[model samples]
Target: MKNKDPKANFGIELDESIQIDGVSATATKFGESFRGIFRWQQSFFKLVWKQAIIYYIIYVSITLFYSFALDSGNQANFDAITSYLARYTSSLPVVLLLGFFTSTALNRWFSIMASMPGTNRPIALYVASLKEDAADGCARVDLYIRYVLLMWLLTFRIVCKPLRKRYPSLMSIQAAGFLRDHERLLLEKHKEQPGGSSKTFPLVVYDWLNILLRDTCQKGYFSVANDFGRNIDAIQVLKKGGGNVIKFASKNVPVALIQAVTLAIYCYGVVSVLSHQIEKHYLTSVLSGYFPLPYALPFFFYYAWLKVGRIAIDPFGSDEDDIDILNIFDCHINGAMRLRNCYGVKITIPSTDRSAFSLS
Candidate 1:
């Protein structure tokens, strides 16, 4: 995150050049909310006001131009025409369209959030259902759980920008104890091979888990038929969740729908403000002369809602308003480690053919 204070800043402030003023908090820390409308750093104000400024300027200019040019009688006639237009144009259809579009965008956001695996629940189940009490059995089970946790984190790392930032590269991931050095080297090697497009890393983790499960079953860890089936089912649940995340991440909200919504909002904003200005010219003329900021309130609200909906439609980006993906992964990792450590199990990869599972 970048600081907004001029004293802490080195470069020219673009907003200053534009003559758009804002009250920036010099000492506001991460996760602190600057939420109220009075605070210039509020998301609604920051996102909405910049665009609203343009329309406001247009409204004031138009009002002033008319006020000076028109006589009292002609001004009344012009107001009548605009009032008539307002009656037809400022109807409920615009609101209905905005409502539907915003609802759809919100649904898309929740859908992506819901697609993530409930890793803690599945992890608790795995820990509770461990049939083997022996040291080697516990270690193998811990290793498998660690792989599952790693796979989930890797899935998020690919789709979520915040997690990608935290684990910038394979080396960072290796340093974080999620990937062994050999594993990172192997992934890097696969990445260097250049004939075809690279496969996503989560799928590689998925394949490795499947191989681990089969091998462990063969080695008599999950010896009982019911236990093996149940364990496999748990793994499948995790795999399905990961698949859902990947599917959603690869796809995007329909562009046509987004454009339609955006077009409607801005166009309606223009129409609504224009109509209001003409219909209430006498009141607006006075306000424009005495206090210009009051004229911008309705538009500020309208633009803010539209801007909020647009931001909500895609919540996986690196913006401050986005979903906290890095913290979620950190929680999952901590939970997995705690569960494994409680059973005194060491979670190291076995020295088998580890080269085959490559994330690169």
Candidate 2:
């Protein structure tokens, strides 16, 4: 896992374990780093061990049934079935299916990360666009930024479980300053409107944001001929980004594809156990028994691969391996607060100054 950026995570005291000291720096130093296999959290063994144990249990039971319970006729029939399954397991197309599926999930994961909002972006633009005595511009921008953040939390809480828990309702959001009392009332009232649902409140917020932008522009904050609509464009970009995140969250990988891969893994596991046995010698066949060690290694890896794909397919989850969306939100809010105070500083330039490299 990569360390959380301390620059972004300023003023928020999170647990130390969440930010591992040297993951990014030491990752390429093979001998000194890459100790992930030894880690329990998000490790392959951690993900697949329970499944592996269950598989081995069933395998041992089958061996017991074969060795002690089966008569010669039944044993012969079992051998026939085993031989048949052995011939066809190689043709299961598992490698190709898993290869394609996992890669698609990984790509989607990165795309979602791309679409996620970094709150500092619009604030940066807003503070720069506004002019004032001292930092009045920054104060004016903060109000609009609050609405943007509120809109984000309103939409994302529905998609992100942890954020939902963090702000259980708009009332909690109001307490936290993202939502004002009148606005929360309006949001709740609007949710009951004929065309509006709970999820549509972001649009209401967006409409309000639009009104603010239009008013601010009409008042001549930016020169009408020059950079007037930049804030509008910023809002549109923010809206589109939020919409894309919701879009991805809504449209999931097809159930048929998930089912096919799941069935393939388990079916192969079942059939492999049926046929794959250790044999000391076969003609006079000495130790023909269910030695599951050979299966364990491959089973663990295959199952872990499938799980990795499954986790990546929807990286919004609260699992250890999933994206820490709560952290992102916290970082953005903190970064925005820090950025707000940083501008409107006085600077001086000397008109008579010459370049240091100038030779008179």
Task: Name the best candidate (by lDDT).
Answer: 2
- Per-residue CA lDDT of candidate 1, range 1-360, in tens? 111132321222111222323433442865334423365543566786567667777777767766788888987876776577567664636567667777877887778767667565555555655554544767675667667877787777667777777778877777766678887776667667764112456666667777876776666655465665676777778777777877776776678877776776676666655555443457755775434465456556666777777777667776656775655555555566556655535478777776677775
Off by over 4 Å in 2: 1-30, 71-73, 134-139, 221-225, 278-291, 347-360
Clashes of each: 0, 0
Q: For residues 1-360, what per-residue lDDT tens digits would candidate 2 score against the true structure?
A: 112355556544333325654344355565656565476767777898888778878877777887779887888888888889989888887888888888888888778877876556676777676665533455557677788888787778767888888889888888888877899899999988898787888888889888876766667664343444777778788888888888888887888888888888887888777786534265323233545776566656788899999998878787888877777777767766766776676568657655554765
For TM-score, the strongest prediction is 2
lDDT of 2: 0.74
All-Cα superposition RMSD per candidate: 12.9, 5.1
lDDT of each: 0.63, 0.74
- Worst 10-residue stretch by lDDT in candidate 2? 278-287
Q: Alpha-carbon error at 18 in model 1, in Å?
A: 38
